[model samples]
Target: MALRMNVQARLDHRFAATYNRFMAAAERRWAYESRGQLLSGLTGRVLEVGAGTGVNIPHYKNADHVVLVEPWPAMRSQLHQKVARDARVATTVVDAVVEDLPFPGASFDAVVCTFVLCSVEDSYAALAEIQRVLRPGGTLAFLEHVRGGWLASRVQDLLTPVIRRFAAGCHPNRDTEGDIERAGFTVLQSETLKPLPVVPWFAPFVKGAASPADHP
Candidate 1:
């Protein structure tokens, strides 16, 4: 059991690291402008989940401080390097997952999640945690890939099993926008964009912001 767990952990780390390197160029090609736009209006202390390679680090101008939560050690190592070299703002990198956050209720002014919900073990739980840690009327900004049209959706469903085995457990077909609404957040705004023409499985993206319906 221990050996299997260790091997899986290593595999997960290696896959995440490789994915970051592979996607770095694609992100530049397909998501450069949108990345900055997605993070345009954030303010106060913020929490960002799955800060892969700290790609969004350069785009964060409004936040006073950013607390990055990344569970994968390999990604966190790269994140640390980026944070060290970044002199623009304050950043704290924590080795933690989104489903279970280590902050108090109403601790953050906003939460940011980009291209991360598809891989979380429990998307609902992660959103609940995001809701809990945010201040009343705080923002939840996200940019995620969702299920596409019928043909694309079918392809996503077919490839999900094999993709999960090697692609850091990412689900190609997820109704992430609906999941966000169902998590008791009032959808403020949302827009869909197309990914690169070749990767149909990763096409049909959504970028939006939401706020919790109420706070206790």
Candidate 2:
């Protein structure tokens, strides 16, 4: 896993450009499925993780503050451009990894992540960071693609080894919800949605949050 993480960190830019292009198509699908779901997912001081190109800016509601954390430099540049053209992106944007957030503990009301975790080397570590920065009980809303059941996992296992070498370490069979659970977060609500093109079982991500009950 550490080696795989290194591979992803190394190929960040090459993947960023391609990822940015396909994002529009993915967002179109997400819009059909999530629509106001993304909007409803956001509230109060928010932090959108791996906020690639800021596709979520328009989906967020009015808030006192909003922060976007994206590490890929190429994507960060594009994210800046996306923000410049928008009027509501009057908040801060940081080019940083989620594993090392630049905020204090319990600083936000919600954390938003959309279509960004598929490539994270350590999704669990990133989730821990999200949990750390968010105020107790603060919601962590996200849209992510993860490993499907048996057959899909078997296929992903075969293709993943090949894909990572060329596709920027993106995994097609990561059990995202399970990883989130291992990261110490409760799954509030979730579902299996439509599939993506080329890649089977990858589309219209499940939306869920992780906050402890009566969180300390």
Candidate 3:
């Protein structure tokens, strides 16, 4: 367990370093555009998973209450800075992972996940935890880059192992939309976005809304 934790810590450090270098560039060019619209719509008691460097902070205008869950110490450090600078919404940052959230069941009215599902240790378990914490009729909004076309998908598959070494276990080829469906959420709106012309390998995106299917 100690060895595993050490390895994970190294990977987390790498992810923080890499993201800190490129996050600004990506946001200015593409990420902000792809993610901002979805985040702007979030409201009520909102919980955001993998709040990397708090990229969604500026876009959360509608949320009255916000809780950010981020396990990596590096990311959490930056997230703290962002939260401190912004006081638009009451905010709390929790150092925790999605698979084992610290919040009580049925605690949140909405959850926001973006550029997150790709790196979780167990995507299914994370989604299950999201489901468990969300109030009945709660909303889940996500924006993720998923598996691309045939040629690009093969490249993603081949590169995933190497990427995981430094990218915090990100899987570029995950079928995130399908996983969301199987998690027993009724997808309210879903759209497949065209690939970015510059990086076809990281092409193919999905953004949409979903609610618990069994909500009463």
C-alpha lDDT of all candidate models, in order: 0.86, 0.72, 0.86
- lDDT tens per residue, model 2, 9-80: 767667777775655675676543473565544668988888877667766657667888888788788888
Candidate 3 lDDT by residue in tens digits, 142-215: 99889888888899999988877778888888889889989899999998887445465566888899998898
Which is the winner by TM-score between candidate 1 and candidate 3? 1
Which 10 residues in a row give candidate 1 its minimum summed lDDT? 24-33
Query: Best to worst by TM-score, what's the order?
Result: 1, 3, 2
Tell me the tens digit of each residue's lDDT in model 1 across 109-166: 9899998999887899999999999999999999998888999999999999987767
Instruction: Give per-candidate clash totals.
Output: 0, 2, 0
What is candidate 1's TM-score against the reference? 0.93
Candidate 3 backbone clash number? 0
Cα error, residue 88 of model 1, in Å, equals 1.5
Best candidate, TM-score: 1
Stretches > 4 Å off in candidate 1: 1-7
How well does candidate 2 match the true structure in TM-score terms? 0.84
